[model samples]
Target chain A: MAKYRQIREDLRALIESGEYGPRALLPSLTDLTARYRVARNTATQALKELEQEGLIQSEGGRGWIVRPRPRPRRHGIDRYSRSTWAAGKAILIAETASQGMVARQQIRELAEVEAPEVVAVRLGIPVGTTVWVRRRTTFIEDRAHQLADSYYPLDLVEGTAIRQVDTGPGGGFARLEESGERLDEINEELAARMPTSREAIDLSLPPGTPVVELIRTTYDISGRAVEVMWSIIAGDMSSFSYRFKIPD
Target chain B: MAKYRQIREDLRALIESGEYGPRALLPSLTDLTARYRVARNTATQALKELEQEGLIQSEGGRGWIVRPRPRPRRHGIDRYSRSTWAAGKAILIAETASQGMVARQQIRELAEVEAPEVVAVRLGIPVGTTVWVRRRTTFIEDRAHQLADSYYPLDLVEGTAIRQVDTGPGGGFARLEESGERLDEINEELAARMPTSREAIDLSLPPGTPVVELIRTTYDISGRAVEVMWSIIAGDMSSFSYRFKIPD
Candidate 1:
């Protein structure tokens, strides 16, 4: 395992140091295994690590190739501006326009279910209380890049459009506002880890790929918990930027 | 590979479902390989993946043991609050205290050097301009948890403690303030990926361990860039919380 990591380091340094430009093609897995005199799995793991870094990709039948595309920064202030959504936009996919990639959204399901243990705690509701749950997937360039499950207190959405398959322009955020649950604050918590098998299957992530799990809690202007969202963001392609003033 | 993942998922579900509690011992790697009828490397990989998730740990001669400690949320807003460090504290260490862990810091190096391309761009300085570079590593319970490199323009820190091995009580932030750079805002750009070999070594991370890389840009009250910090936070152990209000 140590040997595998060492080989990956050497190749990564070469690629990132500009010795190999955008068109650089990496050595085949077979070539690496033979050169390093290690098992094929060793070399494959090394390549998989780079693929998880967004440093290389398998070009059809060809071997691994470098990609020079820039990863877009999801700016917190700009992306979350009330104006961005009030103008009728999907919050997460709005920034994708600059990446020159087509973003496709699929509303997997809209259902009313008893809140799970985790969701209940975040939404300040009883574990068995019914809540409006929306599960959605986002695809960029035909590749699933994000998966989200958002839970809203049933009381806040019982007669609102938020319970439907499509919440229309601006999605749920706008709907919540029109219903008097004007969002006052959003708290986002982030962590990273190896993707679970279920997540790996859902995102079609490569081996060794990690996912950024973001738990977001939204509160109404009166500080009432309105919605709690859990999202798995593709680690290799997603980045977040936040601007905040340091409190005295 | 599929077999390995299948085994991992099954065992993970069992643990999470409370079939095995915090102190339960996992089957040995050899036992897993034999039971699953797979290559030893495949079994090792599966176990390594779990270790990266902070679910289990190798207890030396005792083999792998389960850990059920809740991952503590690292409140980003409070950590950067002036009141946190004003009382003579390291902001990051302060948050770790809530986890009941002791943070030991090592001042790796304090030097003046020409800024790297990335640092230069963030600092709004020439590529080869001199800067005060401070690299430090933080450990919790003998395990490295965070690695950070902070850079400041030489002109701003030439006569401050920020260029010393230990920047007194509040570290560089205090020194920056003492030098007339009253920090008013900070911007953190976050991304996740498998750790580079150097980062893995610095943090003593396991295979498949992904790190949350935060690039923080600090600006003074006058909106002039004062410092740019790059930090690699331990993936499974640390979580960041950000609280922001939607503007009218």
Candidate 2:
């Protein structure tokens, strides 16, 4: 094997074995070169390969550190269970708490804006129709993990808390139910894609990390799409699980 | 805005407006340079940006062409409904037919191998247990769209059609049902990440493309894990939709 590839494999094994835990720094380039009896460039090449594999990241002059694999936020069907949210348990808080992390939802932007073409179609509203949008960044352990933008038709939430920055307690769905909407079903469409530069910056994603785009439309008893939420979640930090019966 | 960014935005608007449809060739470097009155490098930078955004790809000496946005395979819950598959309707065939395309499943490998750790854990079997693995690549219109590896316990499928390269009619699930193990439910876990070099090559993925990893476990009526299938799907070519009642 090439000298650099051998070194990379050695380091990869160490990282995978958890000898170098998350955020743990690897040996300095000089040390690696001396230890492996290789040139400085060869040592650098080894680290670069690992970085490209999303294993470790260079900390500028401080050398490379193992990239922390965040506890994946599992989005199970039960997360949206009406009983859980209706009882005043916020899903984000409950999720993070179970993982022993603090959670915070920052209301980034809340305003009445013209609905985007995609959002309008999901909400079954007219193109260019005015809608109340509440955009927020969900943070786990002070690190941004998700960007969610929720849109509601102006007429449906004209005076409701869904138009506010903070929808309180059980979040927007509970508020919708209080207004007599009676939440019934949710349709989620998921796609994986390379994040746009803007999303990469907002989510602090590592290079080579993709993001999962989830568009969830919640419907009421009348089968009207009451809320449409678009979420961009750091793919490395999340997994979604769905359980369903085999329909006849 | 910088000159390259300005040119990029102009091209983006044109592409978005469908003036430059999928697979349509973009203006040549020389044509762009002359029209924009910019240096060759500036024009190159603009095209590079579009490539990075996954909107275009270089065709060697043929210049750049808009990347074809493959008709996304929408995986609704109905795809797995018993009626759809039990009636001899292969989901992939039905899906591509609806999109006016042909579908083919290429069975690349069939072997009895020692179960890997993750597969064993999901299958509730001991590690290194001998299992049957059927590996296949699903192609849409002759383009590889998905790679699926399905694992089954040897004892369960030792004499079944699942051990064959062709599982006939309804595929492995159907054969399992015919063996008297009635299918009950499915649990799917999904994540997204940049593909490995091998996966990228197998999928013919372009730069900036990601892959969605879906690990699905099928349970029998007795709640035993009958099969575990891991699928790697080209992210840009597919979307998964799941609809379910909001659990009480």
lDDT of 1 by residue, A1-248 (tens): 49898878878998878787786898888889888988988888887667656567788778887765435436465677788788888776786775566787789889988999878998887898998899999888788888989999887888888888778898888989988777889888888877766788899886556789998899988888899998997887688877889977
Candidate 2, CAPRI quality class derived from DockQ: medium
lDDT of 2 by residue, B124-242 (tens): 99999999999999988788899999999888897888888778787777888888999999998999877765787898888667889999999999999999999999998889989
DockQ (C-alpha) of model 2? 0.56
**What does the lDDT read for residue A63 in candidate 1?**
83
Question: Relative to the unseen true structure, what is the C-alpha lDDT of residue A188 in candidate 2, on a scale of 0 to 100?
Answer: 95
- Window of ten residues with lowest summed lDDT in model 1 chain A: A68-77
Instruction: Flag regions of model 2 displaced more than 4 Å.
Output: A1-56, B1-55
Give DockQ per model, in order. 0.64, 0.56
On DockQ, the candidate that comes out on top is: 1
Off by over 4 Å in 1: A1-23, A29-70, A73-75, A98-100, B1-9, B12-23, B29-70
Worst 10 residues of 2 chain B by lDDT: B46-55
Model 2 agreement with the true structure over A1-248: per-residue lDDT tens digits: 99998898889878878899999999898888998899998898688667755778989988899988777878888888787779888978876687677889999999989999879999888889998899999998888999999999887787887877778788888888888899999999999887766787899988667889999999998899998999999999889999888888
The alpha-carbon deviation from the true structure for residue A27 of candidate 1, after best TM-score superposition, in angstroms, is 2.8
lDDT of 1 at A129: 93
TM-score of 1: 0.88
